[model samples]
Target chain A: MPQTASRPMKVSYQDLFWIFFKAGMAFGGGLGILAVLEEELVTRFKVVSREDFLTYYGISRIVPSGSMTALAVAFGYRLGGFWGTIIALTAMVVPAFAITVLLTMFYQVLKNTNLLPWLEVSVLPAALALILAAAIKLGKDVFRPSAGFLLAAGAFAAVSFFKWNPALVLLAGGLLGIILFRSSQGEAK
Target chain B: MSLLSFILLIFTFNLLTFGNGPAMIPMLQADLVDHAQVLSIEQLLYAFAIARVTPGQANVYVASIGYFLFGLSGAFLATLAIQLPGYIMLPFMRTYERMRSNAWVGRFTRGLTVASVGLIFAATFSIGIKTLGEPVTWIVFIVTLLTIVLLKWNQMLGLLLASLLGILLKLLL
Candidate 1:
């Protein structure tokens, strides 16, 4: 059985905001943001044990929204109730929001200049590379040797080649998984 | 667009989105860029790149697009719209946890996870078709792929190097 902490840990809203805000400013993406949050909330502050932190993190992934923000809200609620949830989420998003607005504003100033075209067009390779990397990483995780491979390939072809709507493709995949994994023999994983 | 319309549009998108930012990209492109003509492909990709290079969630890129379409207020509204409905739904996850032990829910969850991987791939394919053509671009793309995917380098470092390579390629070749 998992051991629970002896007493409840006290966490201030300011700490939640600053930790997540710093995470927002420093990390590159969702997974990175989650990692930073774990470091601060679990390892450093001991506000939540590693197990609870991970449980909330897992919940964040299965939910519909952005995983990082969801985790922030979950963790906040865990520690400080409704207001904490609101404060943590706001803190997590604000830095990203501010930077995005600033970047776009700079883009407006630069768009008319020659440098703008050069930067935009030239960055295509980098952008595409990053996208491909993400796909490959996610693909490896979801694709098993045989059954998963077929599902992933089908989903890829359906969307990329036939240009089927992605939402439909996902539903089909889910339905197929339900059928395939329904059998006892298919429960190997 | 008016703030109400902007909020409605993004809220609709966020409500349907499952796998976060990457999954949201293709839908946003089709609706905002192709159908609505709110922004051009170049601008969309530009915002994507900015989101990539910056710290935090890639969804922030949507705010940039909102800024392009309707200035500062649009940006704020767009961010709120993309997040609010979805955030509201998070509290319901407690209920979901109880239902998760049901057979169908478990299967559906697994399916969504697997399908999300494919969705990410499809999103990349759609974007790559437009961006990758030139020989130098292919070279840069391959190098980046090998470094990041194969060797497992830090993403931020990889992006910075790729950006420099982009500049150098533009200047020289």
Candidate 2:
């Protein structure tokens, strides 16, 4: 693991606010904002290397919450302790939340009009496209040529074809991973 | 359902739907139709359609539907419920960071990633089947998929183009 020799700089609350606020501004959804965040924090600030950031990003998704939010929390804690976490999470979420609320309100008022449904029909394909793009990107990372691809395929089949409970499938996959990847030294392979 | 029940339901729904806003749809439909009787199947479908076309989480559609059915209070409760889990859990995410170095946890996350991918793929198939039922719809779906995969077009652009094609086909053919 590459570590910066100098102590972590003291990032003020305002700096924290701006960092996350910029992230929120650039936020397009999926890995897009993360790309911007990597450029700004990892590349510009030298906070962490690209490999370290990607590793964190990948691991963050597997945890039990929103990956972006989890990343914000992690980044904050890493830079500034508890207060850093608070500032980072707030900066990341507040702008987006406000925008979502305004958009939702506007949508509610305009929802019954004749044009809205037409607009919806128009945009639906894009949503599908976005999903496909995200899936492909994630697949590139996780779908190594090994058994990982088979595991992903099995998961897709179970959910799409059989409509099995997602939670159960996830649990089973995790257990399978442990059994398959555990090393002779009892470490995860 | 009563306001309290509605709020509780929404909150619980958010808590369990872990991936993103769209993941909440099937669960929301189950709760709304089977348990709460808050929405009909048609209304549920409409809500989902609206969610996709909009820029935010599909869960936000719950607010509009709630407001339409029950009024301002319903909207407030619905919105609060949807956001509560993420908001409440934000503070404790720090504690979660402490455990990241654990090897077992790493393996667990690796497994979970595979599962998450599976879940998203399943969602894609299910949504695709229902939304793209007609021959023309299938054509539009294929075209859009190819555009994204081949042309490397921005997804928003592909969606806009596909939607226009959909409407044009509906109007002309």
Candidate 3:
């Protein structure tokens, strides 16, 4: 078992490395995979509650880096310090990197074929579905009767309809969250 | 092109983009389409399509395109350039945890999440409009959505079914 820390639990280096490595291989793209990590590692392992995971997910998105990679780094650091962060991040990326390289080579040889195009067009809609499902799953916490849903919807409209820049939209939502959700107690619950 | 210049360009493009791998599409298109004598527009589009279907970072798909254009060395150079920023920055992410309770930061993130969701929605809408333009495609989209959403089917399985449907439609109709 990992040691208990005041805030984030202390995790073994081996556990941290494997957790992230498995996560990267299983989950593709940082965003979608982060959600799965939250569910499996955080919630299931009792490392954090759903609420805490949601909060972390929110922060990861707010930051300027890849959400999945950021989460892995943060989770690792929380559990095992600087070295943990390195292990986690590397583990998360390496598997995907290797797989991608192989796929790229295979694609190069088959570039002239009709089958690849057929496969792509066929899979595009499904990819969209997977992403949408991920969004729904992640957004469930904010789905209740509150300003969160409206904020999400508003942000969606701004980008989807008005073509507003994402960074700007994020800024607006953050400001609104501060004003609307702020409390002196500093408790999300 | 020199490996250094190639790496620099890939890194620069990765930094400027917002969305992961897919966001690099337009930038790659701009760089490779008119300027790079290596690839055609059709080839680039095909590369994009392949990248989307494959799991992992969209950047990897771009790397695949690079490999196609300039062989194995080009692939390594491009992938390294794109991934370098994330690898270098990973170690430092711990420092930001201290600011978890900062009101301003919290507010900022909340806003960013909202914006990201919006961007996601927009992306979904745009793709949906373009790909689901035809009635048959629309049917496939709706059916797939229902299967995944309502039936709660496995994502990969749903994708496989949809792909089969698409190929079958193409073959029969």
Candidate 4:
């Protein structure tokens, strides 16, 4: 809700390339890049307004799954054209993914290890708890003395007991929301 | 699964894998676990756990599945599959913004969020069937749930405590 207004600055593709290349020439790596990006992207080059960044960020956060990559693509498209999309995406993804791949690789290597069962045994219950907690929290927030309860219960039964495809169920929920919630708001008005 | 099917599967599911990381469980479980038998619920949960602990957002679970099934190229492909939705949906961002203030859009989003939560609840049932195999794990789960929902413990800490409790209970009993 707090808005930070950003003024966009004029910088060419050549300026962008020099910022990256000469920053490497001058400021050094890892720690210095943050400063460069803050100076250039935030204060100097100023590609996206803060509102634009936050709006895209909010969209990425609210939606499921690929928040990070989504933001990368969004920002990339804003900063450059098609090639900018590729470079920004790669820059954002590659290093962080080392962390993602490393543990999974270990999971593969440790599959037959005597320690894995112990790891699995410990992790299983924790995973279940996490899932249940999210359900309880969201349910508490979403459900009220209304059709919301019916929708929630319907969705639960469809997926859990009746074995409906969750994607279809989600589409159904959206349609119902349009019909159900819209009419209720209409009545209140 | 064929490589193409795998790509299609990830792409389709990521579109609906809304709300949060945990909301993803039932959808992933529905196809990948129950139908295809590609991975067990436990393995999937482990991957979920790893994704939670690691950097980035929820996409890592897809990456893990890809890596588990078909190695590095699979990981790359899965990453692309998951990322595709964001790209496809990008142009509509302005349309979404225009619709944001409409009463119908709010209701639509509410419907989506409520159903996503419902999916998470269903996940608790389906996953609980496989996960709560022993009394200790059940106890660990319940205590962890209480600590999270009631005592207001943070998710990461609660999970860490629950896993540690599981290991401790295993050693003791």
- Show where candidate 1 strays beyond 4 Å: A1-96, A103-111, A114-116, A119-124, A141-144, A183-189, B1-78
Q: TM-score of every model?
A: 0.62, 0.61, 0.73, 0.55
Say what the interface RMSD of candidate 2 is. Answer: 5.4
lDDT of each residue in A104-166, candidate 3, tens digit only: 566657656654446435665555565566566656656777676788888878877888866
Q: Model 2, stretches more than 4 Å misplaced?
A: A1-121, A142-144, A183-189, B1-53, B65-74, B88-96
Among residues 3 or more apart in sequence or in different chains, the pairs in candidate 4 whose N, CA or C atoms overlap within 3 Å are none
Q: Lowest summed-lDDT stretch of 10 residues in model 4 chain B? A: B51-60
Model 4 docking tier (incorrect/acceptable/medium/high): acceptable
* Native interface contacts kept by each candidate, as a fraction: 0.54, 0.34, 0.37, 0.49
Instruction: Sort the candidates on TM-score, descending order.
Output: 3, 1, 2, 4
Q: Provide per-model DockQ scores.
A: 0.38, 0.28, 0.37, 0.27
Tens digits of lDDT, candidate 2, B1-173: 77787777766766666536677778877888877776777666666555444443344566656665676667656765554444333444444345545677556556666666766667666655555555556656667777867897654467568878878886787
TM-score of chain A of each: 0.56, 0.56, 0.72, 0.43
Candidate 3 lDDT over residue span B1-173, tens digit each? 56566667777877777336777778877876777655687777776765555555555665666676667777767766654454333433333345556666656555555545555566556756655554456555666678878997865577678868877787787
Model 4 Cα lDDT, one tens digit per residue, A1-189: 111113242655556555443222211111122223333454456664432432354355445445545555555555555565566555544543565567778885744445444644575576566656544543564557778778878988999989997667877876787777766442211
Please count the clashing residue pairs in each candidate, in the order shown: 0, 1, 6, 0
Interface RMSD of each: 5.5, 5.4, 4.3, 9.7
Score chain B of each candidate by TM-score. Answer: 0.58, 0.66, 0.71, 0.52
Q: In model 3, what lDDT does residue A91 have?
A: 78
